[model samples]
Target: MPTIIMTKWPVKLDGSVRSKAMAFLQKLSHDDTTPGLHVEPIGGSADDRVRTGRVDQFWRAVMFRLDGNNERHYVIHGVWPHDDAITVARSVSLTVNPINGLPQIEAASPSVASAGATAPAPSALSSESAPAAISPAGSEPAAPSTPAQPAPPSEASPAPAPSEPLLVRLGRTRTELTDRLGLSADIADHALSAPNQDAITELAARHEGWIGMALIGLAVGESIESIVESLELDQPHPSSGSQEADLLEALRRPAARAQFSFIEDQEELRQVIDHGDFGAWRVFLHPMQRRYVEKSYSGPFRLSGGAGTGKTVVLVHRARALARRNPQARIVLTTFTTNLAGALRDGLAQLDARVPQVTGLGDEGIYVAGVDALASAVIRAAGADVGDAVRAVLGEDRSQPNGRTTSAGWREVLDGASTSLPPEIAHESFLAAEYALVVLPNRVTSEAGYRRVRRPGRGLALDRAKRDAVWSLIAAYRAQNRVEGTLDFAEAAAVAAAWLETAGSLADHVLVDEGQDLSPAHWQLLRAVVGDGPDDLFIAEDSHQRIYGPRTVLSRYGIKVVGRSQRLTLNYRTTAQNLRYAMSILEGADYVDLEEQPESTGYRSARSGPAPTIVPADSLSAELDEVAKQVGNWVSAGTEPSSIAVLAGDRFHCERLARGLAERGVAAAHVEREQPPKDRVAVMTMHRAKGTEFAKVVLADTGATSAERDRLESLDGSARADTELRRRSLTYVAATRARDELAVIQREGRRA
Candidate 1:
């Protein structure tokens, strides 16, 4: 029996040494004529050099010994650089039959003149003339005439293999397993030794069919079987289906289902105000509502509805749905005003616990902000140079004349010339216009811009005033940027859209709240962000509640209306009588009954509140007193302090009402166009009260014969505005602030 010892390579060898070693082995193997003739490397050019004390350096070597008698055992050493003949030098000698005390020795043959000449063929060597056996210590052993016998074969089987291991076949021309796996050869070797066979199998299965042929040479039988199994040529893992089920189960938790339910409720006429998981309930939407939740798609989607419908609710729901569907995508939620933005944020938060994560349209993912805020964000992201220019031209303290002139200059440069302006120039011009409009008062810029110049004293010159207004706008922009370090919601959305277009595609869906309130600019910006995709655009709005300003035209934007408009007509918050009263005031002859169902505990109107009083006040102060008295009574009757809102037709009336209520020891807070501070009773103008609801409401100045009513009806050009504003106000005032009671207070001198 021969013993074979395996050791690591001692030193890295160059290409020449490796080639020579291979050639020598081939020569030795060709000369041997036995089935199991072992050919191994001995210390030579290919051998690893190792330190052998102070005497010399030894080479790590391999020795082969053959048992069959007819086979020739050749010990070849040394690898030549080229075809140079190796000088057979006596460097190390071997000893044979040491135990038998037989002395044997061999000497290296001198270099032959024909160095590159091929050695004599194996057929030239006779069995009896084979080389004598030499021992490790350089002794030649005496040869015996008898032949050696063969050993019995072994009976051990290979180890059990992995269940689904990857199999790779090496290419004929290449020794690498990479040709087998279709991977780069370098990766193939390490990949085969990957710690997790299942992961490798899964990875391979991703490439499936072609892998079988590609990996043909590298796999043993067991590994091949595993690969076959992975290809689904065999049964799949028994646990696969269960694992899928587990994933679904994780997604269906209460938190996940909340948004879906909220959306369903909104669609079903439940009229549930901003309740439930706003984020999760949106996820439960049917295909139509879900469409709006998409981040990107064709738009011009119009969400038109009457007052008290869940338009804003749907918008928040859509946003939630979008966030849920695309956890990684960014979503921007913006409204026209800071107040609306805050309401949206609060409403969305109330809808889902995760809404907090989705709120605040920061520069980061999925955010809620106002228009100005969004614009600011856009300016900042465009880079400091553009941002500074915008700030300079739009700064409020810069004076009106200069700002307007600057704005006109930039607008003229950008408007029709946008195609020609470089990105930097376009950005600067946009900033100028944006700042101009943002900072200028409504009187100067008009709520929406077409073109306008200011008169000196009366206003600044058209171009000069525009420039000055632009400067004023820039001031506000700077303040927002420096103070809060955030863009207003509108600015944020525009910036976010720009960011998405540049950074990557927008989210899979986008949900806009208060869709009716979105401006043309906002819609345009959102359209740009969504781009062209299969994604959906969902907008929820009540046209009747267009109290803040003009609503964006959905039809003009190319959004096709699908199915009939979804109407949430049921009035869940008010009593049938209250709904009737409110509707009559709003719709007059056109009002239709809402048919509210009775509550199980039996309906009660604000714990025995008064039957709306008609007072005869001599003056505004007298009217204020009457209104204050009514509010005090509601509080005494056990209504929550925050439940009551003083509804007025105008800001002046709201101020008077707030003062009167305050003087009566009622701690009330005015609901401005922006967010209100916490802990105060609300005194909101009719226009600002659209989506909000309260426990009890006092609709003051409702007397038909009052001067206010006459003024409301008398203005020919303002008729539509008054009607819309009044109807919205009546609906908002009656629907909200009436969880239990609604009070209509009109001076006695005024006729019905």
Candidate 2:
């Protein structure tokens, strides 16, 4: 069978054109000789391989045809009118990136590439002709002979201030781009000519293949190695010793997979067409993301990136890849919340409907569940109930929660018991953190064990007397839960972990999403279920987006990804304008990943758009009124109503926004647990909005003070700082949910 590649799948189309394109691909894949297809060559094309096929009476498919001895490959570049199709085919040619040696679509004639002026002869730069433009590693870059002016403010300043030099971004020079990394002299000279970061971004927007990616990486202050890694330019091409990879062999690499996909069957082609750009990540992921999904690891592995970098997409694809690689392997895919786990399950199905999924802890297929749900499954698989588990932690008072967290029991104990603990430490946040991080994970049953236990990363220091007071409260809390026969999430997970340790491995591999939200006890439970070997655990998380869950060090929980962790630096979802807005939320905040190192890198979005709008409104009514107007404008501009979302900090505001939309004669639905229906606008809280995206988003604030945001202002010292950071992250999360446009309506009356 011939391979069908969707190169640069275009979403810009009318319904008629979209349908025609899909029909064209469907027929071309199954039988290329169909009468309507009319596949043939374009006479005046710069590249003779260029061909045009009939999509409809008015539309034509501009593509490249490669005929092999056994089969042919159809590479669809775009769908356009007849004249445009011929023009594009004539201008385009397939060639290899001189630096990375990856296949790319080049528009200039091969003569231009061959000329010694624009670039070197394929592999080597003219040794003595082009002077070395940089110094050795670990030293300040040598300045160009002619002094350069300072960069202007408002440039892409994610990495450093605009006052810094741009031609030598991240201190990388022409010699580094050409020799150490990979870039042709012409491209290297072009990047070095850019006046500032803004210029680099503008240059990236116009170019394709490795040129755009390499330029953006330079602007972001990415290291030479990271830029290579980010581009997946380091991928092993079949024609390694030659100038470039063969068309067929190049398609097999992650580099090619970023903009191209090989259709295996008709169903996949249909699904890819149906989802379009929304599902593009599944089919066209950057080589870096594909690396995380396809690469093998000695132990647990971690993948982190800022919002919209396709971490979840990688996780979903990795899950399917793992299942297909080992049919008999028992895999567990889990997260912190039930809603997120459900999202993962839906993602797996959307990725490939044939992925084998099972419910129990069976030694076959993949089991998708929340960590708590997995604990429940583990207990049941061991012929135990929730009430019977957690005996080690709760002792005689141990009981099952019916799957609900007994966290409230801690507050109840505080109200019932008497102590002089500090007000900050007396709060539920402090107490819960102590129990989950120190007590439960350490398995401290008595006050004596708690006193002897070391609190490694706990923010506050507890003296013996203070420890006694905390233990008294803990003892009372356990006593109440013991009598009620209820276990909080931490205790239940602890019990499950203990059981799994004794029962041996219950899962061959485990993949975790939103991993930053899980507690330490949850991590222990996860480690217990999976065997400790190759491909043991795969975690996808972004510390900047961690709105829920604790700050945990995975190595402390025995799931080490220290040397195995990698980050994706290019965002595929949010527009560059909105991405700058989203990143502004974390401007001064310090956040660390599961590895516990300060996040040092920044990500650049692939798309660019208008800057996000911020409206300051006095009342809930005014905010919603503006939101309604914005929604109307978006819909009138051809964006689907179902592709718009209104997000808030809490459920009350979400409901109010939904009601306000209704009063304004607009269709809107309140979303809580599940995704909203496709026919109406969806209104949901920021927390629930995670893992979801829309074409346009309106972040509206009602008069009600959110519990989480209120906590941020109410606390003091380190605790308050942490709460404020998470609050910033929540707004960042809601903002990034917008794929195209975003509007933030601040309720001045509520906070100001």
Candidate 3:
């Protein structure tokens, strides 16, 4: 029996059409090659081979053939009205580009080309090739359309002269091209140096989805580097085995599968045929993501990618795999914030609802919670009373006069120290960094230890006198916290790490998502929880999306990832235009990996959307009005209010905007890294917006107050530059959270 590949069309059908389609699919699943099934041929270009089967008198299912290793595979492209399905079957043409090995599509009929007729509405298959119409068996296809000639480059607009051949011009060998383009070596080499150019061209047409587009772009004078940067290829691994088998397997890739649906077993196929839709995430692993999930590491392993690259997805899957493989294993899924941990728990639940060991802050199986929450839990298990310490800083109960919230106390310290700072130091920022990077992680309790400790990544230098003053400032703050019986996050994390070393391990494996936001103390605690052995740690991180926490290398904290690291370059979320806008904000800046390696490049998105809008207003009030109007527009366009977010630079504006929008009848809620309520627009500070996403985002304020800018400027040397970069990165994070649309609204009037 032949294998059957189902496209995404069944879900698009309804009423009579859907019922008929299901009946036809059931019959095909029973016997795909049965003569009575009536898989009639539709003549077209060889690369666009197709066939049709009747769903009913008015509708037909169009499909293509892929020769698999064990048997032939029939891929159902779509079920359409008889005429539309047949027209698509006969007119479609497919091809792959030689350079990138991605697919492209075009109409094969001369009349359609001459008439400039648009293709039918998009289906999963239409995303790959043109729709074709049925032609009688043995009837010849219509004459191929003539290719359009390019207009000559004018005096003002010039194109580069074709020279040195495309392959020679790229100056990369097969291996370099394969690695850079994220293609298999065979596909990259074949596209560049295939013995028969026509054979390569023919292959391009049959696999025109992502694979064909790359080859076609190369054929049309596009540069390999540019092509590599423009398209998102979820799995760029090279193809192997026979050409037919390789091409067939490529079509089954997670990226291509994302467009169409595919089912392997007959029972599942029947259920899908009967129900018309199967959950999309069950088998949906982009090639890169599959590798990340399935590969085994001998020790600590990390996966990094840009926002929406599915790092968290990999962690969820990996957690499930570990849980299922070892019944005795205890696993923990963690992230920097509670909201992200909640999202992770929800994701893991979807993957395996019966995993038996799912709990928050538990000791065994799979536990999902924030890192700090886990640390506090571990501390409590060790017989420590952590409520007062944790509550003084994080608790929302502000009714008591003696409450010493971390934020309020930190601000007070900054204000008191600012008046007495030496010229070389930015007192507030410098003291905070010293505490986090020096005192907390290193467990430096005395002045001598603080003076001897090395400060890496801190750009500013401090003399002995300055260091003494910083230590005194830190001591003063610690004394205040001690008096209040309150512990800051770092102090708590430090204590948690030490307690874990003595209290014994908490789990067999620890999987961290949003790993980039974790501080050094957090990593130390995570390291102490699991044995240093196989599968001990699996983390997904992206420094480009680091919106909070100090930057620290994992290796420095004993979590080494020297040879066990992967970088995902393709972004599966956010359209190309929105991604480009986000990239432009971080352009020219440098970042490092977990081990301090230079950042990798070639980040690209496979999808496209409208360019981000920047709305300028005469004043702050006008900016708020524009933001509110934009939110209303998105709602009018049918987006859920919960899918929209409005972010600002500080809490005051974030809260004010949420209130302003609520007054305008837009159900808006101010959420700060807490579980966002459904059906209401979320408004939060940029810091709180980290590790979260929305369909549409409105950045309420972009203009920095003159006083704020002046204060930053007063900082000495690169410290000022670092602050600005962090601000820009925060904006970038907010902008990229928008999967479809982004609008930046800011005031423009001069300061008094």
Q: Name the best candidate (by lDDT).
A: 2
The model with the greater TM-score, 1 or 3, is: 3
- Give the lDDT ranking, best first: 2, 3, 1
lDDT of each: 0.40, 0.72, 0.64
Per-residue lDDT of model 1, residues 125-147, tens digit only: 22231111111010011111111
**How close to the true structure is residue 20 of candidate 2, measured as C-alpha lDDT?**
72
Better of 1 and 3 by lDDT: 3
Models 1 onward score TM values of: 0.44, 0.85, 0.71
Better of 1 and 2 by TM-score: 2
Question: Residues 132-205, candidate 2, lDDT per residue (tens digit)?
Answer: 11111000111111111121233333454456458664566788888755666766777777766656666665
Off by over 4 Å in 1: 1-304, 355-364, 384-508, 558-564, 588-618, 671-680, 703-737, 748-752
Best by TM-score: 2
Q: Any runs in candidate 2 off by more than 4 Å, and if so which? A: 97-100, 108-199, 206-208, 223-229, 232-245, 273-279, 385-389, 397-407, 702-716, 749-752
